[model samples]
Target chain A: MVERTEKRHTEKMKKKQAAHDKIMAGKTAEKGLLIVHTGKGKGKTTAALGMVVRAIGHGKKVGVVQFVKGAMATGEKAVFDAFPGNIEFKPMGEGFTWDTQDRARDIAVARGAWDEVKRMIEDPSYDMVLADELNIVLRYDYLPLEEVLPVLTGRAPMKHVIVTGRNAPEALVAEADLVTEMTLVKHPFREQGVKAQPGIEY
Target chain B: MVERTEKRHTEKMKKKQAAHDKIMAGKTAEKGLLIVHTGKGKGKTTAALGMVVRAIGHGKKVGVVQFVKGAMATGEKAVFDAFPGNIEFKPMGEGFTWDTQDRARDIAVARGAWDEVKRMIEDPSYDMVLADELNIVLRYDYLPLEEVLPVLTGRAPMKHVIVTGRNAPEALVAEADLVTEMTLVKHPFREQGVKAQPGIEY
Candidate 1:
């Protein structure tokens, strides 16, 4: 009788313990990582913005630095307006590089923007960072990939960083923890002959 | 002098004309929107994986669903482990409500698993929706937000939805118009004797 009782008791304990193991395990993790959203597709900036909202929803602090495509009043501005003090929205305006006749001025703006954004990446306080449209900078060679990578990866406070734009360099892809390539199957501009719109395009 | 002036005016007028309007003018948009991530995160079978990723990205397509997270074997599995797949990861068992509990059964297995996840957030083919915390399902709810959202949204076309969780949500977030969230902040677990090692509490 004792032997039988002992066996039953052990089985019950095993069952109980299995139940306990599931939730208690895997609850801890490091603080930060990187996600790169790039490709020949649209929505790179939009994806970064989406992440910004998701981070904020979970009660995280986030910053957005637009490396290109900064004309003004994009919808993301509405989010910035709604949140007010919580979010820092910085738009690095170059509008369209091809249209900028002044090469010196264009280079100046690119340089100025990178210096500002690089400073932000190095700061450990930000919970999440969005380097919007920064891909173009790398693609256009406005910034050196090697110089930017270590700073972005190292000092991020274990916080999250998102870099978005088209034509991300192969080197950048290799370094990213998570990388997404947006492929454009079709776009409306091809049919309408309409120029880019405000709020939407900018 | 008058004839010369007229000719000069005509020449200038006929020289060239170009117009540019951004998309924000409400000209074009992604036809259908939804998110699917077979990547990683804490919970699965807890929410529909598509709704959140999309709405947060673009403002199109809506009404989709998933309970539980993507399939396991990723970073998310480390975080969520064997959390519930029922009632969208009910914290009642091991919900991480306060963050201090052995919480194996309460955290891992749920009552119905896919049976339960299949019930909530039905059909993301409609319009914008939110599949909050669906990853818990994977622990028990095991519904694979990836397999579900992709086929559904791909078939629906021209709608938007979002899916939220860690570990990729990749396949979905990749095809998603937008994807992002959860960089992690001052979590309370660190104060406790918690460490996010793999399998057990990643």
Candidate 2:
């Protein structure tokens, strides 16, 4: 019985290895990518920050532009600020939609943030650029797709870009190399009556 | 026309502020939580690491146990290693399931990792504990639910715990204070024929 079980496991392992090797063999080409994190769940921006940390660990510089969360300083921002030479953080948003009810002003601020992104993209010093909540503005049509899409797709050949928010534009999704939708399965605020905490949420 | 727009914006801001204040009034309770990141997306573990970075920034000690990723040194591990006194990382997995075909051995290793987790939970020194990929082992029944759920629910009242992986158990989900399901809208490996890159995917 033991011998039969061992033989079956060996055969299974060999088959799985062959499949993985075949798929990995065709995946050798490398280039900078456009990644999107969207949907009605948490962790979109948090995941982008994770990439920033990874890039910094590799001795690469990172740039972050917060499009709609500039009113308050967050825990993540504090940590990012600590890495002075490695991280460049520009919090440009005035506030949330309800707090800033002027659509025209929101559009103007979005343009300003995009200008910063364009500058960072052209600078070879920044290995990765994170456009935090750029999707929210894009979804609200605060920025023109004709302008945003071209600059993103035409970025330096080896500079990675990450755009994060809830509702990414269809054009951006089509042009992205990777897109993840964070589905809202369960939320503490809704079910367990828990509010966001300092270190974990921010 | 500009004056009218300004007046409308001011009134809207007032209403929004009132609503925010009312919500904030009821959110006075603060406590530790169990946050679960699950589903078929790419950011489960990455999101948890973001919190780790935040906790370390606040001078909070953290304990991380990688359940199924012990074979190699990752970029994140290097970053965690940099914070010698603040972060403790243990990569306890032998490898992925296919790499290790022995179910009995996998169970034993998982038990060993859980022993470390219990110790971390009871110890007051660590502010947060991240059980990376614990859900995968639980999904495979390597660790029984009855044995796992109690420790998770009975942890230190002030110590935060995060469990990340795909296919979280129903019992675990029910017990968790926050749960996020990362849905795979698009993947570079499947859609763009791109392989995982060094600083991004690792």
Candidate 3:
């Protein structure tokens, strides 16, 4: 029985190896990417920041422009702050939509954040730019899709951009090279009846 | 009109504050959680490590047990290695199942890794324990859920445990306080014909 299992496993391995090698052989082109993290679940921003951290680890310059979550201090911001030279972070949003009901102000702030994004993407030094929560701003129509889409497509060829938030637009989704939607399976707010906590939520 | 907009904004802020305060009033209980990152998309492991980086930023001890990815060096494992005292990491797996074509050896390694998990959870020194890719082992039945669930349920109240992998069982999902399913919308492998890249996929 052991011999049979070993033989079967070896056959399976040979098949998988061939497929992996063939697929990888066709994958030679390398360039920058526009990655999107969106959906009705947690870890959208967290995953983007994870990429940022990875980029920083690889000695790549990273710039983060937080579009709609600047009201309170977060642990991520604090951690990024520690890596001063490696990270350039700007948390420019006023707060959530309900917290700031002024449409004009939200638009102005989002534009300011976008300007920063433009600067970061254009700068040759920055390899990765994270537009944190830019999806929410776009969803609320604070920034016109025509304007934002053009800027994204015009980014540097070697610069990776990560846009994160819920309800990402279909146009942006179509434009992105990689996209991951975080699905809500279970949440403390809905399941355990708990609010967001530090280190976990922030 | 400007004055009217300002007044409307003030009223909105007042209503939002009241709602925020009301929701926060019931959120006095603070403790750790069992967070599961699973699904068909990417970022399951990245999100879990993002939490680990956040915990390290907050000066907490972290223990990471990598179940099935120990062959090649990853950017995350490299970054975590920089912080010696803060992170205790064990990349216990030989590799993925296909890479290691020995089922008996895979089960043995998984069991050895689970022993490390048992030690970490009971040590009381680790504030957060990340069982990275534990789901894959459980999915293959290398380790039974009956044995694993009890150890998880019996963990310290203040300790946070994050389990990440694909095909997480329904029982573990039920036991978790937070679960995020990363859904694949667009992948480089599928769309752009690219295999995993350094500092991004790793």
Candidate 4:
């Protein structure tokens, strides 16, 4: 009975491998991707930062502009600062929307951060640009979508850009080459009154 | 008009900050988290690796065991190798289930990796343990869920264990303190025939 099961499994895997190879063979195109991470869960920014780390590992230069989380100190800032030559990490926001509570100031801050993002995207030296929480500012209309979309879609062909936050606009999703929505399944803060900790949430 | 706006913003922020402080004050519990990153979209392992990087930044020791991606050379492996004192990165699987085609060998490989994970969990020196793609092995029954859950749930009070992959077991989900499901929004591989590139997928 075991011998028969082994034979069946081998045959099934052989067929599956053949199919996988065929699909892989057809994927020949290579270019920079316009990636978006949105939705109500965690890991959107964390995953984008992971890509930043990967780029750094490959000796590629990266630019990071945080749009909505500049009031507090983050562990990423301290870590990325260690690689001054490879990464230009900028946390440009004053705080969250509720904390700021000033529309004009929020718009000014978003514009400054967006301007930095535009510079990084335009510069050929940066291999990857992470617009951290850009979607949040966009969602709040602190920055105009009309101006932002053009610069993103018209970026250099070989430069990757990552935009992260919740409630990404439909138009941005339509334009992005890759998009992932993080759905919150369970949260300790909501259910068990646990606070966010260092080396985890930051 | 500008002065009025500023005045209103200041008052609103003051009230918001007080409320925020109260909420934070209630959250005094500090303990390790059982985090699960699962779903059909991208960034499951990527985000987990980001957390690993964060832990490293904080000078914490970490153990990473890859369960189903040993065949390919990954950028993360090369990167994590630079921090020998901090990260013990191990990719143990021969390949994916379809690539291996042997259930017995798969199970043995998974058991070996799980043993490593258990060791890391029990060791006091390790601050965080990442079971990368363990969910895939669990889904395939290469490792018994009954044996895995106890080691994970009963881990040390301050040791963080991160499990990443798609289709996490329902029981595992129930036990996780933080769970994020990466949902597929748009994929270039399916629509534009773009292959996974270095610094992005690996």
Q: Summarize candidate 3's per-residue lDDT along B1-202 as a digit string, tens digits.
A: 8799778776876798788877777776667799999999999988887888878777789999999878535567556665678889888998787777777888999999999998999999999999999999999889999999999989998999999999999999989999999999998887787656665776
TM-score of chain B of each: 0.39, 0.93, 0.92, 0.92
A best-first ranking of the candidates according to their lDDT comes to 4, 3, 2, 1
Q: Over the stretch B12-104, how does candidate 1's per-residue lDDT look in tens digits?
A: 434421233333354444544344332332222222321233232233233323333223324222212222221122222233312222224
Question: Which residue segments of model 3 deviate by more than 4 Å?
Answer: A71-74, B1-20, B71-74
Winner on DockQ (1 vs 4): 4
Error of 1 at A176 (Å): 2.3
Candidate 1: RMSD to truth? 12.0
Q: For model 3, how does the per-residue alpha-carbon lDDT over A1-202 read when each residue is reduced to its tens digit?
A: 8799779878887788778778889888777889999999999988877787787777678998999878434667556665678888888887776777677888899999999998998899988899999998898777899988988889888778999999999999999999999999888876565767666877
Q: List the residue pairs that clash in candidate 4.
A: none
Model 2, span A76-139: residue lDDT tens: 6556665678889888898876677777788899999989998998899999999999998887
Specify the highest-DockQ model's number: 4
How well is each residue in A1-202 modelled by candidate 1, as lDDT tens digits? 8567556655665666566675456445454656676656455565565456555544456777776656534345544454554577777856655455344565677777777677767766667777877777777666788888887767554667778777777777776656655555334465434344322333
Q: Is candidate 2 or 3 superior in TM-score?
A: 3
Task: Itemize residue pairs with steric clashes in candidate 2.
Answer: none
Model 1's alpha-carbon lDDT is 0.49
iRMS values in order, in angstroms?
13.3, 2.3, 2.5, 2.1
TM-score of 1: 0.51
The alpha-carbon deviation from the true structure for residue B7 of candidate 3, after best TM-score superposition, in angstroms, is 7.7
